[model samples]
Target: MEPGARAVPATLHTLRKNIDSIPQGVQSVVEQFSVPRQQIISDLNNVSHSIGFTIHSLLKEQVYSVLEAIQGRAQDLQNSLHHLQILHKTVRTLTHFQDELGLALRDRKESTVSLLDSPHCTSCARALGKAQSLEPGADYSRVPSVEQVLKTLSGLPKANFPDLIDQGNSTFNSMPDLAVAKMAQVVQDLKDEVNKVSKKVQSIADSFPVSDYTQPLNDALMQAENKSRPYLQEVKHYEKYRWIVGIVLCSVVLLVVACNLLGLSLGACGLAMREDPSDYESRGEAGAKFLLVGVGFSFLFSWLLILLVFATFLVGGNVQTLVCKNWANQEIYKFIDTPGNLPPSTNLTQLLNLKRTLNLTSAYQECKKGAGLWDVLQLRDAYDLEDHLHLSQYTRDFQKRLDNFNLHFEEIHFLDGAGRRDLETFRQSGIDQLDYPMFQAEMQNPVVRTSLEDLARDLEGLRKIQRNITIAGRLANESQALWKIQNATVLTQEALVVKLNESVQFLSAMAPHLQLLLKQTMAEIALIETMLPVQAQRLLRHEIGCFTRKELGYFSQYLNWVRRTLTEDVASCQPLATALDNGRVILCDRIAEPWLYCLRGDLSLPHPPRYSSQAIGRGLRHLQDSDSR
Candidate 1:
């Protein structure tokens, strides 16, 4: 071969040694921008995928969280709205009830006069009068009527209606005749009002749904659950189906073991059959015949060996001998003795010659009297010992370090020594923190050139200056504009309230009709008074025509009923009003929460739980301090 040329190394040191050195300025001119350019390209290549991937995952996780919050809040809002609507309907029904009651009251004058003339009303009034005079719980021989019902329901003590103050007739002297008569009309009015209210309640219930709000709430919660469930299910189902797959795999392993055992048995049988030369063909026979002979012989011998090994000594047998020739049959045999023929001839010839009642058979047959697998048995006993020891660490270097640490720990077992070691450990750990993942990044995150708190004085000055600058001044102008708008809105609300008061006054001014023939009833005057109208003052002076105890009692009962109805209506509507108010407050608070949190720099939405990595040295120090305590 011809002599070959040698190539020098192209590495940095080799290159510098071989090539001439350039001056500093020339070098900078040659590679300054080029090296940075290459570095930029390399950084872009290395960081682009990581940055994009990280951002994508972060965005997806944040989006899911946002969606979950939205769905959950939507459900809350839906429930609030639904309940508000239901309450609104209830209020509307109550208003309708009030309207119907007003109509009933308007038409009751004629009905009142007729009911006052009824016999039942007179009887009830007389009973009530009698009751007022008699001891409590005393029985009177009178049938019950509407007056007794009212007297029973009134819950008042020793009060009498005007009907009981009869002046013209002696027969009606024991009764509050006028009041009892008027009560029948009141009863009819009550029934009509209850019926109308019932129908309204039923219609409202039918129009609104029982499950509409509940179903939406459930769906919203379910949607939140589903945000994480779909992907999580892929992982969760792995545990579920894993059990099934494990079962299948276990079955396959068992089958393989069984097949292996069977193959071993077949091979052993073939070897066993070869011990019998008579079963084989002649040496001059064809190769096919040998194979046929071998297979046939294997099957025959395997069956025979199995029969003897398993069936003969089935009591305590080791049939493993059938598979491996090296193993011996280990079966226990039970034997029963029989007299010899020689002994029979000498002393028990009669017994030997006599017919036996039971003919005893082989030990295996006598024990079971059944047909099954064959086997035999042989036994041996032995024992062995074992040592169970494992290395604490796999690699020599790690094990050496572990052992050294153990020795170091032993030497520093005392409190003072241990504390000194702890400090040293902490010093080492502090150095280790420099290599901790994201340590520098985490440190950089909480640091700033100028924190908001530190820049407070500067911020004030900037604010004032920004008020004059064109760009930042817009924000100041907008803020002022918003304040102006809010003030205007307050003024507008006050104006609206003033207009409402004026409207009420206008309505009150138009209350009395300019007709002399038509006189307004006290009830009409009373009804209008609740409207907060100024004209209601006329009710005090209205001619009710010679007011008596009976008339006064009648007015009290009516007013009591009206007062009770109004009380119940107001009571029932309070929760609805409260709920609506709370909903409004919650909406405002929720709207303001982010803004307030942003201004304070304290917003922290809930994310999935994770293990937070603390500084190694800090954690160690904390643990040590806690242990010392």
Candidate 2:
């Protein structure tokens, strides 16, 4: 994280404080150092009365090159670690997914009984054949029960429900198989890459004189894994029995269906073939025996069947009513999470090895609300996660190594002692000691006593005046002599003014520095000699600070991200809740509803129509009496 903005200079300030902010701070320092370095270089040439001098920053070319190489190596290490981290996390995800996939596959295979194994299918096939044998004309309607059955069969959906489910399972299994194959290759490659990156990181860590800063981060990762191991193991243990329970329940339902189907098939077949009611060898007699046998079996097993269904209904219904519905409304958490409401062992905080209680209501609500894991779990109650991100113990050795590096400047002497003394003496000379404003005022006046151009003009005028020929000629000669003198005086005065201007400008430029240059020069020399090592030490420490801060900030961000994703996204209990709801639907809707509907149909089936000989005799006697009348 960034240092507070007010603590740092405005130039170093960042709008957001995080791992990335470190670079801005370093850039600010680099810019600050560059200004002074450039100033010193430019001003070195301007040192008065000095020659054959060179000046540069204490940071030499070789040192910069070495720093650059170190930085590159560190970056390489960071990149390797980043790749390794991604691969490791991916491997963990794939491993968890693979386990879940295998469990699902096993459960599907176990819970799904073959269509041949279901007696309902066999009985239905037999009944369908019998129905087909009946005449497709008026005879079909003679048996009203059969007519209704045919109508119902015709109305049923064309698709086989079991076959559709099997097809769906096949489609589902095929994709996972291919995906798993590709994922296997991908996981192997990722594992190999993780190893390679790990070795590379180790090599880089070894190259550093510091203790490895990555150790703490690695330990943190391991700690998280260790913490989750127990929970995963518990799930695995529970999964072992899940399919067994499903298969047992399915078998119970199938046994009952088989008995019912056998009885119905025998009774229906016998009734169709029966003709003579009094014949002992008649199929009707055999059918009546079968019906009684079926009744006896039903008497023996029906209670057991009812008991199973009732048990399931009681447990499942209550769970749906009391637990699942309340869970949906988020009310169950409050009830269960009350202190001492449930046993201590049932508390998730106890399960997770936390010292303090994490309110179930709060945890569930936060997860549902999509809060970050660190906030949801309140892991800070156990340990300070941010504290582990700091790399002071690791980076101190690196700082020491940098400090030990020889960064002393070679003794720089722009001038010998005598030369420096002479320069000082020149600075003290009366040249710049003059009253400059007075000199400037005095020098403003023209050097000539009169205007030369005006004198020349006057001479020309005198020459032009009309007079005796000899006197005019004499005046012209005198005017020419005066003009020549004026021109020479103008040139001489202009040359003198140019030289004086140069001298005055130089004096004015030097005047302010003249008072303090010697003391400053001496002080600068002394400071360079005395403070170069100390400044270098401070620079190393500052660079170390920046490096560690950036690294630690990055680690802290990573940890926070991992925590957030683990609790809020990856390890959500929503999936478990959803699975429970799905199981309820499968038990109640898919299994129980169909079974109960079949039972209703069986109970509603009509008994065969009875015909008595006595009724036939009475009808015959009545007909005889009618014929006699």
Best model per TM-score? 2
Candidate 2 lDDT, 151-194, residue by residue in tens = 22222223233343344334323432432342344334333433
Tally clashes: model 2. 0
Worst 10 residues of 1 by lDDT: 376-385
Q: lDDT score, residue 513, model 1?
A: 28
How far is 458's C-alpha from truth in model 2 (Å)? 6.0
lDDT of 1: 0.29
lDDT of 1 at 289: 32
- The positional error of residue 411 in candidate 2, measured at the CA in angstroms, is 7.4
Model 2 lowest lDDT segment of ten = 135-144
TM-score of every model versus the real structure: 0.14, 0.35
What lDDT does candidate 2 reach at residue 249? 49
- The residue ranges of model 2 lying beyond 4 angstroms of the native Cα positions read 1-422, 434-477, 488-490, 505-513, 516-539, 560-588, 601-603, 608-629
